[model samples]
Structures are given as C-alpha cells and as structure tokens.
Target: MYVTEYPKGDVDKEIDKLNKKLSRSFSKDATQVIRKLQKANCDALGIGRHLIAFYPNTWKEKDKNEYLRNVKFKTNVDVEIVQVGIAE
Candidate 1:
C-alpha cells in the first residue's frame, strides 16, 4: 500500500521507524483475515478460479470441496511513505 504521510516531525529516523511499524501492523491485520477465511474454507479471493485458469493440472489433483482448507497462504504488505515536504 502507498501511504502518503505529511508527518509533523522533521526527523528522518523517526519517520522511517513509524513507516516500519505501519507496514508491520498492516501485514499482521491482513494475515489474520486470510487465516480466518482459510479456516472457514472460504475462497473469497477467487483463488480457485485463478488456479483452474493457470494451473489446471495442479488444480485437478486437489479435492474441489477441500482445496481452500488445504491451501497455505502467506500475506505480505509493503508500505511506502512518500514524504511530501522538506525533510533532510
């Protein structure tokens, strides 16, 4: 995600730290949601459709009803803070 922050602080070090924290927070939140969906066997992201389209052989080997439960998802969120004003 692109985060444009007009931070009140002028310290570059502090801003970088804040950016890292924000990134981690976002990543954690997203991962939790994915885990919940996986546990419920809910393929809300249409992953199965993509698999059928791109990986037909791999898709055919899995049980259609249990595919979501068997899938492992790793979520990564990258946040870039675009500083607008003058900061070093």
Candidate 2:
C-alpha cells in the first residue's frame, strides 16, 4: 500500500530512482501514511500481507527500526523500507 505524503508524480520515482518495481502510495504526511496502511489491512477490503515503505538515506538507523517495529505492532504485517537517498 502507498502511504507517502508526496505528490503523485514524485512518489514511486522518489523511492525507486532506478525505475525498479516498488510498491507504494502517496498520502499527506508521515503520520497519516502509517495509519492508512494499518487501516487498510484491517478494513473490509483485504490487502496484501506485505507492505513496502520508502525512506531517505540520511534517516537514522534507530528511527528506521522504530518505525518498522511500530508498523508491525499496529498492522501486524511485513514492512519493507526502500531507500530513496533523499529526505522526504
């Protein structure tokens, strides 16, 4: 599921500069993005068991791990981070 706050044209490309296949979506900000993904997983409409998130290369490792742990706790799904090398 996509959960970034970036503009439509910039979302996927921002994370996959090499034009690789990556699963993502755009939202309004960092906070709402995670909430939406969690909601999607529990909603009537079924979503996938895996989620892919994009992060900037400059992100602190601790923060990254924390976010991953939080997502799993909330959604109980697999979370993967894709590095864009640039902060959002």
Candidate 3:
C-alpha cells in the first residue's frame, strides 16, 4: 500500500519526507522492526532489485552507493488485530 515519489527536488529531502510518511503510517513496534531490517542493509521493499532488473546494463557499470544515495523509499503498513484473547 506504499507509494513513493521521485520528486523533482533534492534527494535528501525526498528521503526525509518518505521517512516521515512511513513512520506516521506504521505503529511504534512496526517502526522498530523496520529499523532493525534496515540495520542489515536489506532492501526488503525490492527497490534495489527493481533498479538492477530494469536497468541492468547501467547498474553493472555504476557504483551502487551512487545509485542508492539518490534512491528514495516510501512504505505503508496494514496491521490487523486478529485476536483479543483472554489472559492465560
């Protein structure tokens, strides 16, 4: 349910906006999980993969950091509260 924009503006600004959007969309627990996931440098959202897949020739020749530094991300989360169980 996430939507990302490649705005015609500064990359850092875009990333900052994206971070704020994602943080607001997720719960505190979910935010912590995302931070942990990011700690491993895992682009679970497939952004890096998409770039590599669509731009293979260019990707092969370019520095990954250069590409990643300019990349922006936005994430949305839907959490369903499945059960409110009795305390055991």
CA lDDT, every prediction?
0.79, 0.39, 0.56
- Residue range with the least summed lDDT across 10 consecutive positions in model 3: 78-87
Give the Cα RMSD of candidate 1: 4.2
Model 2 Cα shift for residue 28 (angstroms): 7.7
Cα RMSD, each candidate? 4.2, 16.2, 14.5
Candidate 3: deviation at residue 37, Å?
8.3
Q: Residue-wise lDDT of candidate 1 within 13-36, one digit each (tens)?
A: 566776788789988999999989
Off by over 4 Å in 2: 1-28, 42-88
The prediction achieving the highest lDDT against the true structure is 1
- Model 3 over residues 1-88: C-alpha lDDT tens digits? 3333344654344555555665566856665665665666566767668868897887787666544544444445644332332345
Q: How many backbone clashes does candidate 1 have?
A: 0
TM-score, one value per model: 0.75, 0.18, 0.39
> For model 1, which pairs clash?
none
Name the lDDT of candidate 1: 0.79
- Error (Å) of candidate 2 at residue 4 is 21
